[model samples]
Target: MRVRPELRHLFAAAFGLLVGSAASACGTDAVGIDACREIESARCEATQACGATEAEAMHCIDLYRDQCLHGLQSGQEPGADATARCVEAVHAVAACARAGAATMADCPAEPLVAAADPAAITPCVVIARKPEQLADCAFVAKPADTGTTTPSGNDAGDAAME
Candidate 1:
C-alpha cells in the first residue's frame, strides 16, 4: 500500500520510538538499534493503516520479529521498518485470508503467496471480502480438506462451524 506523504513522517516517528524501545530492551549495538528503528517505523505505518483490530495488530508484531531484527543483525537491509512492516503486512494478509474464507463458506483458502511473500498481501482485501464480519472475525488457520489455509480475522466463525 502506498503510504501518504503526510502520514509517512508520523509513522516514522512512531516506528523510531518502537525501535528505540526494542534496542534498549535488547541492549544491542548501533546496527541493532538502526534495525529496530526501521522495523518499528514500518510496523507503525502498517498497523495504523492496516485497519485491523488490536488482536491482529499484535499478531503482526509477532510476525515481524525475525525479518526486522535478525536480518539487520546479519547485515542485510531488510527494507524500511522491515520487521514491523512485515508483521503489519502479514496481519493484513491474514485479514484477507479470513475474509476470503467467509466468502467460500468457512473454508478460507490461504494465499498462494503467503508462504512465498506474505507481506505482499494487504488488509484491504479482507475488508473488501468480509465487510460485515470484521468486528466478529478473528484470525485463524484452518486445515482444509485440500490444503492449509490461514484466515485472518475473528475466529468466531471457525468455532461455530466446528
Candidate 2:
C-alpha cells in the first residue's frame, strides 16, 4: 500500500525516535511511568521473539534504547516534557505489540530507509490504543493525524486507554 508522503514523514520520524529514522522501523502522548516501562519491555520482548531470524528488530531497538530515553531527559535537548511525551508514546506502541496487534516484522524490506512507511514495518506506529477487537487491523494500522507533528501529543492518550 502507498503511504501518503506527509503522514509517512510524521509517522516515520516518530518511530525513528526509537528504531532509527523512518529508514528503520521504529509515537505521541503521555502515558504513566508503568506504561513507559511496559512499552520498553514489550518492544524488547517482541523483538527478541523474532529471534535470530529477525536480528534487525532486536538490534535496532537495543541500539536505540538508551539514546531514545536520553533524548527525552536530556536538558540540552527536549527536556522532561519531551521525555514524558516520548515515554508515553513508547508505552502506547508497546501496549499494542503486547496485545498481538503489531510487530517490527511488519516493516517492509529496507526498513532503515528514511522513506520507508512506518505504517508497514512497525504497525505499532499507527496502531490505535482504543482496544478494538475488529477482525481487520485496518483501524489499528491506519494513520490518523493527531495534530502532532512532533513525537508528542494526545494520540497515545486518545487511542489508548492509559
Candidate 3:
C-alpha cells in the first residue's frame, strides 16, 4: 500500500499539532518555593505597614514559605508565570502601603480558579494584610483556637496565610 507524499505530510502535521496541544494543556513550569518566598515577603511588608510588628512580619514570612514549599512538593501550586504576576501584584500593593496608603484594597485577589475544578487552585496565593482577610482564602488550614494569644496581627490567622 502506498500513501501519497502530500497525504503523508498532512497526517504528520496533524499528529504534531495534536501532540503539541496535549502538551500545552498539561501544566509545566510550576511556581517554585523561591518565588513563593518573594511573594510572601511582599505580603509581609505590606502587613507591617498595616501595623504588624517586625517579629510578627517575620513569622508570617516563615509560615508562608513553609506553605509554599509544601504546595510545591504536593504539586498544588500555579505555574511560574502566574506566581510571578502574583508577586508583582503583591509588591505593587506593598509599595502603596509603604507610601502610607490608608488601605490596601488595590492588592490582587487570588487568581480565578476554573469553574470545572474549584480545588484546582489549591495553595492559594495569599495577598491579605489583615487576619480576617487571610482567613478567607481557600486551602489554608486554620489552627484550633489556643487560649494563649500572640500579638494582635500575628495570630492564627497570620499563620494560616502561609
Candidate 4:
C-alpha cells in the first residue's frame, strides 16, 4: 500500500522524531531482539495518524521495519537504507494490489483504476512509503491481535484522497 503524498512528509517527520528521542535505532530493552523497533514504532504511529486502518498500520510496520532490519548496519541507520526499503516494501504492496487483494478502504484513484498500475505503483511507492495502496493483503501478514479493536478513525478514505 502507498501512503498519500501529503502523509509522506508526516511519516518522515515522525521517523525523525522517533530517532531523536530514542537516541538509538535499536534499544536493547526487554522486548524482542529486533533492532529496528523504533523505526517500526514511528512508521506505525504515522500510519495511524495519517488515517491507516489497524491492518494497514501493521502492514506498514512490518514492511518498513523488516526492510530496515534486513542486512542493516549495526548503529544509526541511513536514510538510503530506508529509501531502498520503501522501494522494496512498495513492490510487495504493488504485487498485492495487482492480485486483486482485499482492502479496508478504496485504493487511490488513478486515471480509470482504483490505484496506479503495478508499473506505476512502484514509483508511487517510491514517493509515499507508508504502504496502504491495496484493499487487502498480498504479502503482508495479518496482525496477531485481530479480536481486539481500537477505536477506528477516518482512515477509510485515506487512500482515495490521493
Which ranges in model 3 have alpha carbons more than 4 Å from their true place?
Answer: 1-32, 72-77, 99-126, 129-162
Q: Residues 39-149, candidate 1, lDDT per residue (tens digit)? A: 333333334333455565455545544434433323434444444444454355445444543332232333332232334333444332221122212112233355433
Clashing pairs in 2: 23-111, 23-112, 23-113, 23-114, 24-112, 29-153, 106-121, 107-121, 129-159, 130-159
Query: How many steric clashes does model 4 contain?
Result: 9
lDDT (C-alpha) at residue 154 in model 2: 16
- Summing lDDT over every window of 10 consecutive residues in candidate 2, give the lowest-scoring window: 131-140
Query: lDDT-based ranking, best first?
Result: 3, 1, 4, 2
Runs in model 4 lying further than 4 Å from the true structure:
1-35, 71-162
Winning model by TM-score: 3
Q: Report the poorest 10 consecutive residues by lDDT, candidate 3.
A: 116-125
lDDT of every predicted structure (CA atoms): 0.39, 0.36, 0.46, 0.39
Assess every candidate by TM-score. Answer: 0.24, 0.27, 0.40, 0.25
* lDDT pick, better of 2 and 3: 3
Candidate 4, residues 1-162: lDDT per residue as tens digits? 999988999999999998888887565432221424443444354444334567876776666555543422323333545444533443444343444534322233322123324444332231134233332211121222543222211122234312
Please write out the lDDT profile of model 3 over residues 1-162, one tens digit for every residue: 999999999999999999999999875554455655665676676565445678887777778766655333323354666556655555554555455444333332432222212232112122352221221221122222552212112232253322
TM-score-best of 2 and 4: 2
Worst 10 residues of 4 by lDDT: 148-157
Misplaced by over 4 Å in model 2 are 1-76, 103-116, 123-162
**Candidate 1 CA-lDDT value:** 0.39
Who is ahead in TM-score, 1 or 3? 3
